[model samples]
Target: MGLTQTGTYNTRQLQIVIINSILVVLSITAVSLRVWARRLQGLGLFVEDYLSIFALALSLGVNALLFQSLHAGVGEHVDTLSTATVEAYSLNLYVMQLFWNTCLPVIKLSIVLFYQRIFPVRSMIIACRSVMLFLAAWYIAFQTTAIFQCIPIHHEWQKKTTQGKCIAFVPFVTTLAATNLCTDVLLLILPTRQVWKLQIPWGRKVGLSAIFTLGIIVCAISIVRLENLIAISNSDITWSDTYSHLWTAIESSLGVVVSCLPSLMPIVRLVKSRGSRRDGKSLTGIGQGSSYPSYVRGPYELSEVSNRVSTGPTRTRLRAGSSHSDLIRKQAGDIEIITEIDQTVESTNHSNNI
Candidate 1:
């Protein structure tokens, strides 16, 4: 059955659909760039990357359910919808909740896995694994609870039936949101100590820490979503739930986007490096038959030049310098800032020895 219209039949369903549609597109783009960045560095796709892809897939599923719910009159007043329309909306929402619960924890796990990849210290790795295990348990428990929340699961959508008992929705949802918020905060703090211990410049250390903690934005969105969920009323639930769904869409899509921000850094640096190379080439007339060899432009070029002209100890020094440069480029490209820092320290020691 189609949505019924009353004298006061205003609906925000279109707004929800439009906002989520845009967010889904953005999330897709972010994940694509993350994959591209890895490929640019010649790195293989890691567990975190695969997990991100999975999370994005689940989020897409949730968005599809959301659109279906909206089409079934999810943003109209309950009284304006026929019983069948309301049932359809409720069924869609029920399925959406399961997807939502699954998608969010996967996003967090992906982030945690990324941390484990970047920081290989014994304590840090242990902490990451512990968090990952906890998240797995959390996801399983919540998904199971969501599936069987009502004594007869069909009663969740077939609200007119009074035979089956259901758990209190608000309390269940509030507890889930609260635990999710706690995990967000934990993940935000997990890497801070390690970041501070980096041997890089204090400014760079702070910048790196900030990048790792970008999940704070997701945490803030989670808080807002929890508040919105709490304020939603059962009366006119179809209309009231629209705002809740809007926040859910924003939170899930933004989580994927934020998780991807660090990986996108390599692309930014690659673009900037290309622009710098172009400017240098123009200023020096390097490609226009200048006296200097074309291979004198940068570290990679210098390494090639040195290989042909240098000898003995000079050759050793040149090769060492070239290796250092290569190491930095590869580490930066890989988005392995921690390894980059360690290599920076080792490169400094090697320079002093030479």
Candidate 2:
């Protein structure tokens, strides 16, 4: 089709889309590989994480679709669109605006859901839920505003004629942008305090907390996104470049992933911990694999248990098999028996349900 002043479909947009598509696939793939790395043992986590990853993938798909529609519909316009192009223009704006706005928030919500398993504490979970509620409110407000942003959702052609009747695009977008950035920063800040309260060593706390504090990443990316939005407001219609769209996609995607990365620590550790368990000789979750968490030692029994358990190549039982009772006695033999203890330790931190 021939191009017109409304805009011409440019190769730059396509390139941005292609790169973003690649990123979407790669991100999802990495998460999927981790979830199903060992199919038999880890499949329980598959459903939840697949949804998590799917949201990310879907957001990317929405971006790509909208990217194509905006270019094709707008670029093909002739001088000015007529009754025929009205539907096309309307559809383009509606789809593009909805995709860019809604899909991103959906992805972010998915991340928050995945985190439920990570922070099992009642208070922490409550905090996460509250933040999610706020995100939902923001999403609703933006979507409602977007739907009403244009007059009749089909009257951009005569848009200037009814100037006083409709909301200006700049004010609407700028308000949305400011609120979004604030929410982004708020969501990012919410988790750092929880990370700070972990009982881990200070260095580990800092390092591990950094992973959860990816609000920093969100903050940084939001700054970049703010820049991009400004550029987009004055973007060249005749030219298409991947840089602007690709970066905006990053701004949106990164927030979801940043919120998500914390929840993944348990997954990564579960994989690694399971590997160590297998190599150390555990074929069942309730077997030695489960025993590891409770297998603490005081001086002599540490050596005794270490000596008794052999991860040999052959499935041969050399030492006299010790019962759980015998194991306790052994633990008590060389040191004061840890009898007076109230304990509430779950199996394997089992937060991720692994």
lDDT for each of the candidates?
A: 0.71, 0.48
- Candidate 2 local lDDT, 111-151, one digit each (tens): 55544544556886897788789878988888988877766
TM of each candidate vs. truth: 0.80, 0.62
lDDT of 1 by residue, 11-118 (tens): 476577678889889899999998987665445687889989998998888778777776677777789787888888878888888988998999998888888767
Model 2 misplaced regions, further than 4 Å: 1-11, 14-18, 37-54, 66-93, 156-166, 233-244, 266-354
Candidate 1 error regions (>4 Å):
1-11, 281-354
Q: In model 1, what lDDT does residue 332 have?
A: 19
